[model samples]
Target: MKKAGVTPHIVHVSTAYVAGARKGVVPERSLDHDARWRTELAAARAARESVEWDSRRPAVLRRLLAEARKDHGKSGPQSTSAAAEERRKEWVENQLIEYGRLRAQSVGWPDVYTFTKALGERVAEETLIGVMPLSVVRPAIVESSLKHPYPGWIDGFKMADPLILAYGRGILPEFPGLPDGALDIIPVDIVVNATLAVAAAPPPVDEPAYYHVGSGARNPLTFRGIHESVREYFTEHPMPDGGRGQIKVPEWTFPGARRVERQLRTGEKVLSVAQKLLLSAPATKRTRHWQDDLTRQQDKVDFLRKYADLYGVYTEAEVVYTDNKLLALHRSLPADRVEDHGFDAAVVDWHHYLQEVHYPAVTATMRKATVGRRTSNSALPPLKRSANGGDVVAVFDLEGTIVASNVIETYLLARLCDLPRSGWPGELADLVRKLPRYLAAERRDRGEFLRTFMRRYAGADEAGLARIVHDRLGDALLRRSHPEAIRQVRKHRAAGHRTVLITGTVDVLVQPIAGLFDEVVASRLHVRDGRYSGFLESPPLVGEARAAWLRRYAENAGALLTESYAYGDSYSDRPLLEAVGHPIAVNPDPHLYRHARSRRWPVAQWKAYTLPVGDAFLETVP
Candidate 1:
């Protein structure tokens, strides 16, 4: 395009971190720097250990222990043992930090936002330079703009807004990081102006031109300054109805192991008491309060886990040092262009921008995006009853209704009995045949049933079991799902009729299929150490349990239970079908057909798949 006489101004917006080389500072960029990444790695390692920790069996555990002992012995004792240990610990900590930083760099900045920008810079350097007019503008912490087209024009919450919201709501109790640490905040207008200036200026031919636009270097504002400003602003404005009126300025606190231990212990004790009260008490105001308190405490715990180690630590101090370079480039441009596009930061007032404008803009924008739209048709078709006063609640059975297979028992047998595809069909036949007996015995003695089952066949590793489920069982189940059945359910939901898929399948299998239904009533299985304990710790779906779940779903949906529709192909779903007003049999088995016919319920059969409302529903809803 450029060779064809098109002058393309490729505006590459990159992070100021890439310009860190000029300031001699390392930027922590990458997904590896993410707190969740570390947490997940630790969890995976812990899980591996937990699954094979017992050494009495000796095969896997002995190999792991021997490897650990070998590694532990590599570091021999030294002179000044305590000092050496301390030094070693520090070295390990530094290595981990560097590892995280490198990981982040590999992924780009600490998150996707900066990494994409860095990629854009590289693209401009490699392809755009000399080919087309190109200028790379680096913005450090591009925050909410104070004055763009107007005052308080913010795109979205970038960096400081989340922390500010947390602080204002008293959700953040302690301040993390060094009080004196540099907080490089740049208003959006300044960033925009720099972008415009770089774009309008003549490109430096034969070389790539760069501009570092930020605040900390030209006009430094410390973390302390930010905290103070936030406190002052919130105090004056007094968050809606004096809701964070008593805003307190945070003091820098250093990381101490003993202090952390004490805090955790205190928090645990309070949380434990709150949890007990919430579990034991019936639904009431006090119970609700306790639950909220427990949730808030957990949030605090999560927050601490992310920031505790780095709290009050002045980690980085580099500022934008490309000012002279940018200024020189600006001067080289023609006078008219320079006058028209000036990348000046001193003209902007950060405090006024953040407090007076940015906050309000963010709140308004979020409100518009999040608040649900109101429809013109207030008189919606009754979800519980059709126009002819027929039942509308459409309940689907798990195994044969929507899904093609009995996922729960199939998954359990595969995991516990090591039943592969070649052998599972026979095993399934046997299990189904013996299910009545096992269920009867389960009611009498669960421990006996589990022991008998495990003793009979429990030898497969976690990987092998997961492979069998995902590759074999899952594939078969997904393939077997009657396309017409799914289409009908989707149709009912689109027609303003409440649709629910009730199953005796475990959460792992059922949750994946949740996208197919409006509400899922799946069995919850207790999993420990990456494997099922081969027991249903909770009551299975039957009788009152099934009816209660349906009734609650109906109540919450504001639909009449007696005027709702239900569809099933099994005798086991009799209670559920009876609970609803309308019962329909879809591809019903002999027993279900007989039962439905006796009850005078409607029977619908479909040869082709078609969503009830069709193209019109998709166009109107989504």
Candidate 2:
């Protein structure tokens, strides 16, 4: 520090990647890439505020929320507001990384890591050129060890380790790299020795020393060479995949980055289409497994995309670093210490190191954490009477559980299915316009959406609406009902355990299935003189209110809340599910599924059914 007064000799350990995007020979010295460090700093400092402003935009917020909860099988948000905040942070962080890369490349660098490090060097030199005696040690890719700290001791994956692991695990089928390009790998021990030598023998203050501690100059390793070594290692000692036999390693064609990325994009597009079709189809055991596999395939593609972006610059770059200074430093060591503490990389064997030490350490840490804790989809939780036998109840959420149809669909079926197809367009258009408001309210509290949307029924004849539900909506509800879910409801009833339906849909829509459960709890619309008042007579039974209502019901009925069972399909039903002894996710929405998986709770998909043409009414509802 400048303020320390006794300004200590400084040894800045920078990466050889500082030679970013530069080709041919790289000398251990300052580069002249015309980057405006001060300007870049100002722009980077203002990014968070800019991102905060962007997060508040309605469209961005909505998209991020959807991504956090429901875009493919990504782990859903833990809580709604918390999920929004978490997604906002992730979005902001990603934007910053992207922006950093753009600015870095604008000044002729590869990525954010190299760009910032270069800028930092410039800032340090400008501030402390004459104030401190400085020496810079630039290491290339630091791998496990050559002969220090015992041969194969490594904790986590380095930059190149992921590619190796992915290849071994059969996740990365192919990779792009220049076969003859210099991959300037240096053993961790060599880098350490080189740094210590520079620190011990500090350069003169005015003439700061620079050392390239890498293998590129003395003994260069090619991308093709490393690939062969990896292939051989994996082929001889194959990696196991669960209980399945050892995975086969695919051969690399050394395809260019453009080709690899193009193939990945095509694969991604196909998977996206498949996912959309699967979501639309009925939820069956086979379909659910296919969806899971799709999610994993998409993840593999994402992993390849990520590593290619992060590590490609190193592997594909043609530059060979000249490390004459480090070699000279190594030679100057005492005769006895030269063999032990030598910083030279020329004597090291890449084949022996990777095959014997590094690969084994990396693979040992890749075991799945969720392996023993998984509950099979086909296995149901044991059904038993509570200590207080009669108190045991099964609670099922209405939408996507007992019935795939939601509030909007049930209401629309009663309100508009009888109307001419020409009139349907106008009604749907009106619904579309108000959909955002309803969704926002629903996100805040399920009861709010029900309360606000139910206002549409005001002044309608209550008896007439009942007639509409009885004549049309009942059949629609049954048509969309999940067969296994209905079976569970009846199973609970037969066992003498109270079965309850807790929903945000109005009681009128629920009346059709009233006989299925012993108790029906739904939003009750107020009626004045046989005409609808368009307001809730009581607080809607959803979310935490529903949980509290169940508690009271259990207490009054001499039942135990802990002895009951709850099945839900929405994140809003989390509170209700948490109130029971057994909580099952029945074709759960993303957020609920994520929660359920984390807790190792039982998850099941109730087989969904297709209804007539107009029955896909709730598809666009939030």
Candidate 3:
């Protein structure tokens, strides 16, 4: 309205959650919690310069770090300086997010989303008071339509849908929420009707009208009621279990936050110990399968913990909205109009809505959503390898060791999809910020960074990705290929050794260069209906996983481990290098250089655009 410079009546669509963290009867009025939010907003704005604009927040931070490093001198040993810079940047970004979260939670709102909404109301109230007639309608959680054009009209998963979906799937065994607390839900149609009614009759000139369009005051439905109705609905219309018969309706145990936190900590420790034990043991197919399962379970635990941490407060709070203005407006409306609009919340039957309409609609939507998605290793067919009866093998890490640059990262940050080149600066800043995460992956779980990074290709088609590699990344990668590395692989081929190009990059991208090696052991991305499922068919073959695969291949093909040769260019490749008798770090990063020196290993720098190593060097083994 301010930007438009208009005196037209405005009906501002806002959340009833402007009540903030205050309990008891929440009157339909403006938010009064400004003391905390003001300080928070100021602090947030002050640190805004630290953040670079990009699609993903994490990626943006990474790019900023990279930029900082580039701005600083890059010569001699930069490991210490680079590490410090990365840590500082990571710490700043983390602190900014943490501070914002804390500031939001401190003022009774569960998250910044709701808290910011309340602040927006303040801005409108202050700025648009004299210019236009304003009526702010604060509606509670808007769910699917109860009765309107359709019985259970829904577009996508809304606020509480994920929790409800999890419950239906028998995954959410427990939730940290108050069963007795009013959920304060309102239908979408009612909110629209209420907005229209308020817009038709705005408050007196210079006086803003506030209405809470929710069911909590007159016809409250508690979380316990919602849960029971959903459970009954699912029990009657049990989802097919494929092979496990009927999936039992998950019995939720509403534990306190403290209890849940304790359980989470304990469970994490147990999972960690088990994972370590599994890692220490032999990397057979059975053991690897178990490890993968544990990783999935760990992912679930992490998600649950985060969900509880963010939303648990909402369940605990018992703030019932008093929609007196909303009721008055409904009463003032024409009898015919009221009948047509049906803006009244008191008439809504919670039992019928949850059991008959909402739950069924949500489940149906979920079914459709799950159709073309893969959640298992069966998604991608295995890559058939020609049987090679050999006693010698050569393992090469494809990215830095062979190609000189990370082709997969380049594909993601540059040419994966046809995006605007104007956004490259922001993206580069994001990559710089994420360098710490990459370093962390190298330091600990090597595949962690790849797993998180590859999620960008979630909905891309398999064939399309191949075309991308062949057309865009292929020529660039081949050009950047280390001549020395190519010669080394050929020498291994001459010796009758099975040359394997192993990488965490998708096998499809690396398939163009497949003819250069006897076997390609790169990570295979799972596909469903020819589209990427955003999951690996197997654990990414990097770090320890790479070493394990090498051992397995050696044993299966009768290759001598003591006679095998491996070449890599990263700290993440340390395990692979250590597995072979001849371990060489080619164009090694600072971390890998230090590690190789400590181990008395040979480190070679391969110039991408320079001449290849002489024939004499290739003829003899170093």
Off by over 4 Å in 1: 6-9, 19-102, 105-120, 128-130, 241-285, 300-320, 328-341, 363-388, 391-622
**Prediction-by-prediction clash tally:** 7, 0, 15
Question: Candidate 2: deviation at residue 550, Å?
Answer: 8.3
lDDT tens digits, residues 388-412, model 1?
Answer: 3213567787666675554434455
Considering every candidate listed, which one attains the maximal lDDT?
2
- Candidate 3 C-alpha lDDT tens digits along 1-622: 5577756887888888877777799888777765544665777887665442331366655665565443222211243245445766676677667767777778667677788888888878877887788889898989899777688886777777777777776666677778899988888888888888888886765899999999989998887888888788878877645434555777666777688778888888998788667745643446645755676577667767767776677767688899888898899987878776858999898888888888888888666655544443221111222235477678888887887567345555224244455765675677678778765654444566678767656788788667666656565556667787787777778767788888887787776578989889877878899988888888777656677888988988888877777888776676678788778877666545545655657666666754232321122112
Give the alpha-carbon lDDT of every model.
Answer: 0.55, 0.77, 0.71
What lDDT, from 0 to 1, does candidate 3 have?
A: 0.71
Worst 10 residues of 2 by lDDT: 70-79
Each prediction's RMSD over C-alphas, in Å, is 20.1, 8.2, 19.5
**Candidate with the larger lDDT of 1 and 2:** 2
Instruction: Output the lDDT of residue 375, model 3.
Output: 41
| Model 2 C-alpha lDDT versus the unseen true structure | 0.77
State which candidate, 2 or 3, has the greater lDDT: 2
RMSD of 2: 8.2
Ranking by TM-score: 2, 3, 1
Please report the candidate that would top TM-score against the real structure: 2
